[model samples]
Target chain A: MAWTNILTDLLKVNYPIIQAPMLGVSTPEMAAAVSNEGGLGSLPVGGLSPDATKQLIRTTKSLTNKPFAVNLFAHNIPSYSEDDLEPMRKLLLQLAAKRGYDLNAADLSNFKLYNYLDQIDILIEEKIPVVSFTFGCLDPDSIEALKRNACTLIGTATCVEEALYLQQQDIDIIAVQGIEAGGHRGTFIEDMPLPQIGLFSLLPQIKKAVRIPCVAAGGINSARTMKAAVELGADGVQIGTAFIGTEESQAIPSYKTRLNNAKDTDTALTKAFSGRWARGIRNEMMNEIEQAGIPIPPYPLQNSLTAQFRKLAQQNNDIEYTTLWAGQSAVRTTLTQSKDIIRNLIEGYEAL
Target chain B: MAWTNILTDLLKVNYPIIQAPMLGVSTPEMAAAVSNEGGLGSLPVGGLSPDATKQLIRTTKSLTNKPFAVNLFAHNIPSYSEDDLEPMRKLLLQLAAKRGYDLNAADLSNFKLYNYLDQIDILIEEKIPVVSFTFGCLDPDSIEALKRNACTLIGTATCVEEALYLQQQDIDIIAVQGIEAGGHRGTFIEDMPLPQIGLFSLLPQIKKAVRIPCVAAGGINSARTMKAAVELGADGVQIGTAFIGTEESQAIPSYKTRLNNAKDTDTALTKAFSGRWARGIRNEMMNEIEQAGIPIPPYPLQNSLTAQFRKLAQQNNDIEYTTLWAGQSAVRTTLTQSKDIIRNLIEGYEAL
Candidate 1:
């Protein structure tokens, strides 16, 4: 039972841990460092163009020969109208003005996000060893094509129903993301009630219901949490927030600092930042936006609107306006090299 | 590494499982059945008279010399005014009329709940082997007196903050009650953000922060769940739903059937039931009461008022009027003798 589960054996990693494919935060260097340290590293190709996806895949391959995963967002594109986008835009403009930026409402219009079909083409063509999808599952045709290419597929499930549905589609692994996880929720339904179960409670329920390996994700930033995940029947553990401050992680300095300064009780779930529920550390902007009761548009529209505001705020050290994505355990992580973090995880597992 | 943890050693039980002290559901016979089968069973003394609490303790002891636990509520009794009572009385009267009873608003006027100080006297005098409390921690005097009596004190905590607070009070065990738990939430601060972390997430956080044994509770009703609890750093498990159908359990026939017919998605948290949020199956009363958006009074008043209504409804075999407390895993539990359920748990843990 010493790291002899299907996940480790299939991924060819020494420890049953995965560097969670964090969209804006993970870099090729970071993924390489984790893979070099005997844990599976991941690069997110979720929202990139096919060419960009291929270029990053090549960059990562050159950096490390060890196994790594490529992640994609397979969510159905949400439709919205002008009426839906007004309040969120109004709030965003006001926040930008307070930050001393002459931001306009039109800059956020024409939100665009296509599904991962083209990205899948690049991954299959490049013979990518592992592929993970969040937000929703792939259709039967895509599932067949990936299987033919010898890709080990991973799907994200926030509830038992989603896990079982993913299992029915015959995926390789299920990343059981609890409600406390950072960034976007991997929920499939647009209006489904948030399955507010925590990581530990959710992991076992999914593990018991499905036969596939479960990669427990969400607030897993420490050795104790990792150990608890393993003991609770996780074949592997996926970590995100803990790697925010590493040399290779792509988060801004202030974002890293905010995460570093956080405490156990600091994080909360808000659709305010991206119009999709995700956990993050609370700040002035979040408080103002949430308190205003501004109805946000769907994912890509509200996300696109806030994207520019977040970037400009980060550039000026104006954390009050940034969407600081972080898990509940964001405060407990140490600032270090990604390799050292992986080494510590192995040490912690052995110590347990 | 085995069942050699503080909770098992202190309780002198063979298995690391404790049938939850469910008021109105657990009987002296149920407690004896569990203790006799080598797990600690608990009797809840919440709002009970000192004499009645003593009588149940004696009855439990008569059935089995094996170790058992006595539980009490440690909540601060809220002060209410006539303004608060008027709205709740209106709702109760309307509900009673629908159940074919001529209920008056004054029936719920005299809301009363005696504190745990008197119950502690009986527990100490009788030398109850184990004692647990919920809603809040015991004060200095009660803790000191309980320690003097050498009682193994267990405190319920829904969040790490509460667990740390309980740790400072020098409790013997921390029952990590997750948000998915049935009945009342044992939160101390009414305004504190509900630490919605599941048992797995909360257990490790508590285990990492404290030195005492942690007993995982909530939605743990099956062998798989019990095993999962043990693997995730739980020294013991406090189960409620699974034991509801046991021969020794005191639940009514229709209530037991409702539990049997429940699904994983059947439960919802409603303050309408007891004025404190607790998860249970949605029914005719729950649907009607919830839809009305009735502003409930504080704990003892609303709880006391509902008690009479539930009693009358049960006598008439009316399922719509009774309060049925059940966890998320209610559907998975089956009707059986309590001893057999205990045996299954032991077998499940060993198999793991």
Candidate 2:
């Protein structure tokens, strides 16, 4: 039952387990620790600047020589004028005022949105071995550029149609994200509504439809779920929430505590925080914003608009105001080192 | 690999497979066919009257002597006056008019809403050996009465809290209904929103929490999913959508055709048809009712109002307006016999 497959060979990892690149929580130390433990660790640069991304990649390289993935947000950058973000700005201001937080107009202004194309040269220059992306597929030019550098591309998909699209783009691996997945949904199909296909249904369908190695992501925190994903035809598993509790993660103490205390039914999907559908522990911020029934601005704009407020809440350790992204099986998370988490997953899978 | 567990032994089946009692689709022949194939067949008596339930039980008995469970809707009966249902009636009428189907006042009136209590005596009189319930848990009196008659009780839960409640009520087996399940959600806990936990995250959590045997229900169609559920700690599996494709099922031709043609992402959850959350294929009726933004009446009331419209659509083989309830894995379904489905599942598990 020793795990070795196309995913392992392509990613150059001993085990097929992948530490999902969780923005805001994942760090260079966390990624390096997981990779050193024989699992594919991911560095999320979806929200970082090219310079910062280079620094993080250099730091991770300093920590481990093992192959690790660098993840980016491949969404189309929307052209938004200041006026377009006015209503959402007012809403967030109103919400922050209720929480006794002061926000000035300057706090939400001058937000720089990162484009996927801008990050390609940085990955190529850094010689990043594996590149993963979510939100949408990379353009043909970006794909060719990354392929020319010999980077293994992993595209995120929430449905079979998206998986097929990723394969059509000549992507090397497909990360099949189920509805139970935490953080932002990787749904890129514009004409259709957000796909909420569970892993039980999505994994097998994607595996049957696509030829590339499919990695199951979502609510996969334990050996049982990992084994179940493999039984359903997944070549590997991409775990996210479980690693948030690891010592190497950069999550706030309260966020880690909430993950430890969460029940299976404690989480819900809300676009209130980032203007993109994400699974997280239901709190006052999610409830109040959703209850207000106002149209949320799209991602990057809304994500930037609420940045100051989220920072203030994080500083105060106010769990209610800050985002607490988690999967349905986040109840399995425990406070430990990244190495122990990876070792336990391997040992547990072996025992099973 | 021969499936013999607490669930199989208690239900008197050779394989730990329970054909889910899909209300409109399950018939006496369908139930008996599954039971005869060494799987526990279920006769859904939730919507039928006491006399009709007795007759169905007798018919199933005539078809097979193998043990089969009788399913009931244990939700509390809502008190609704004619005036209370008037708004919903008018809304349905307006929607029906748009479809060129005249829903007259007489057609929507005089509907009888059956109570779970009324159906208990029929099971006792018929000497039914196994009983199951969904929507909510049965009252203590009903539980005691069924227990007095030596009936093994199976309760449905969509979350950990509901499963613990069923276990506390002394339920013999718990059907852990995941978000990918079709038909009405079995979530009974009030004061919270509907639980949409996927099977991958839900099964293992319920297995850890409950002392009683747990049966995984939702998105379990083929041998792979069945084996995955067992590996994830399910004592058995309760499949619903797969059986709709069976020849013995009472589902219409168009419904069966849709099931065969559906993809994994085809289904969605909508509360417009029944006032309670249920997953089904996206159709005109669901989209229109949801888009209209009118408040839906509670179950039985909304269910009654939509009955005439659903009937007309079914009669004309118009899949658009019909209630095509299905699971997320409906794409895995094939038009076959109940015996072949059960045999395939058993053989598939063995091969795995």
Candidate 3:
């Protein structure tokens, strides 16, 4: 009678809803409240050190005894050649001089990735109940280690073929992502057309082809749509954009306000921020980047090159440069307490 | 714990999801099936005779014992001067002769529109349980007559001010339709912006200001999204494009095929057909219409003038000239059976 699935039972939530692991947007309080309200809440590992990731998990655990998830970006961090950083630095200086800022150089020491392997080790040692992945799959060693610790593993798949591949690896669940999903595309396989499937069309096809339980992700954010996904054979749903306006999220106040004012037609996927396709509000940065016509470097290097610009822009409330990742349902986000948001989600289910 | 509201209890349904009343696409069989599944089903009264309207209601009643709705066009039907029809007639004659179908002059009489008020008499005589109006509101006499018959009167509103006006007119429910809705724009009092407010931003504001229960319409198709609507404050939802894909629909095979194959960006609202804005798949007719640069006549007359072209195109399986009205959520509709679709919607509610 409660949500009929292993996920709902395992998570002890009323329904098989999962708040998305949105880095720079999700917070420990939000995650904990969602978990407490009987839906799996997730903390993102992107842009975090191992210590920070563990601290977030511990803080979330302190807030609620319910099961929660930790999401990891399993892809290898790209190494930036000095050749790449020098030009990016020169461009920044030139732009800054025009803006009347003193061009004082900062120390360029102690820069390194979070050491994903070390983070995985800590998660496994701590016996985290659920570990979901995006960007790429875990190595065989890591997958086996997580399994050995009796952890539920989920892999994000943008296509049916990818879902089948994940099933072959004996993963517990598959998050069937659609083209409308926010953040970096999880397409690591061959270059597909990004065919733009919706939840109603994609869920059944994945359900028919795969043996594992399917979790519909991407643009789902409503009671009616969640019910529709379940009817289409999705065992659970992962929602991200619906929670952007929650009081507990780490999203900037300006970003949250903009999200509240967005329209369904306001969202678009651009490869401007982070050198990968992500859906967000179209802004000046996207227009400028597309006009520049420069070949964007791959992954972490492109991310690192613009890190300072992003920090300065976000601090200045300049929305253009910051990576404002949100899905098509972003405008549906309501300004409310995280607990109240979960309560309304439950009521939406009940109304349906 | 059933989905039984005061209105649903009065109407004898378990849920509040209403199949939006659509002209040309809606048929008797479709209306009955939705009513049988415990939701409101509406038939549009445009371009139908009094006898035809009564016959449609009788046929729907025979198919199911539950209540159903009938929608009426409240806008002025345009009258064509002899100058307008003469030029159009000559063009039609040229085309017919080219196609080797020499129609007698008498055949032209069949293209004229039946009066809207005459159709209303058939609806009142039938004592229909629900009545809806689009494009404008009816006079006080019409509202009084329907209310005396114990009909639930609903009005379509494009903005918050329009909704307030409908409330003042003593409407039972106000349909808060967004810009993405298919078919003609429902602006009654004033000409609104093209592609004005989207569903997510529009729903909350209307719900906040309007005292009457708001029924959310325009581009809703899934449980998760519907949940968001209800959570934001809609008491019910009315969907058009989703139900258009069902087996009971009167849509051509090619129309359904195109809808299933549509991308997120495939739809556009063009005034090439019906002289009113409607969303559909882009086709050669729309392109040619745009290029022709002829001043479009008013409604009903413009719709009447193009009748021959539409008929011929359909007979030839031509996608052009067909008023394939569908919302932005048309991409999500794939159900072939109404029963299965109703069940899926139920499950979507359960998951929420």
Off by over 4 Å in 2: A332-335, B332-335
Per-model i-RMS in Å?
3.0, 0.8, 6.9
Per-residue alpha-carbon lDDT of candidate 1 for residues B83-141, written as tens digits (9 for 90 to 100): 87777677778878977886666567775578897688898899998989988888989
Error of 2 at B126 (Å): 0.9
lDDT of 2 by residue, A237-342 (tens): 9999998888888788989988898998899999889888999999999998888867788887788888999999988888899899998888744548988889
lDDT of each: 0.80, 0.89, 0.72
lDDT of 3 by residue, B62-126 (tens): 99888888888877766567676565455545555655554445554456577557776667788
Better of 2 and 3 by TM-score: 2
Model 1 misplacement above 4 A: A12-15, A190-192, A219-231, B12-14, B99-102, B219-232, B316-321, B330-335
Q: Candidate 2 falls in which docking quality class? A: high
Query: Cα deviation in Å at residue A10, candidate 1?
Result: 3.9
lDDT of 1 by residue, A1-352 (tens): 2677788887878888899888878999999999998899999977677878889999999999998999998866676677777878888888788778877776878655656986777888888888899989998889899999898999999878889999999888999987668888898854545667666457777888999989999867666667667766788889988898888988888888888877566677888877778887778877887899767676766677888888787778776788778876665556579999898878876786
**TM-score (chain B only), all candidates:** 0.95, 0.97, 0.91
Better candidate number, 1 or 3, judged by lDDT? 1
Ranking by TM-score: 2, 1, 3
Question: What is candidate 2's local distance difference test score?
Answer: 0.89
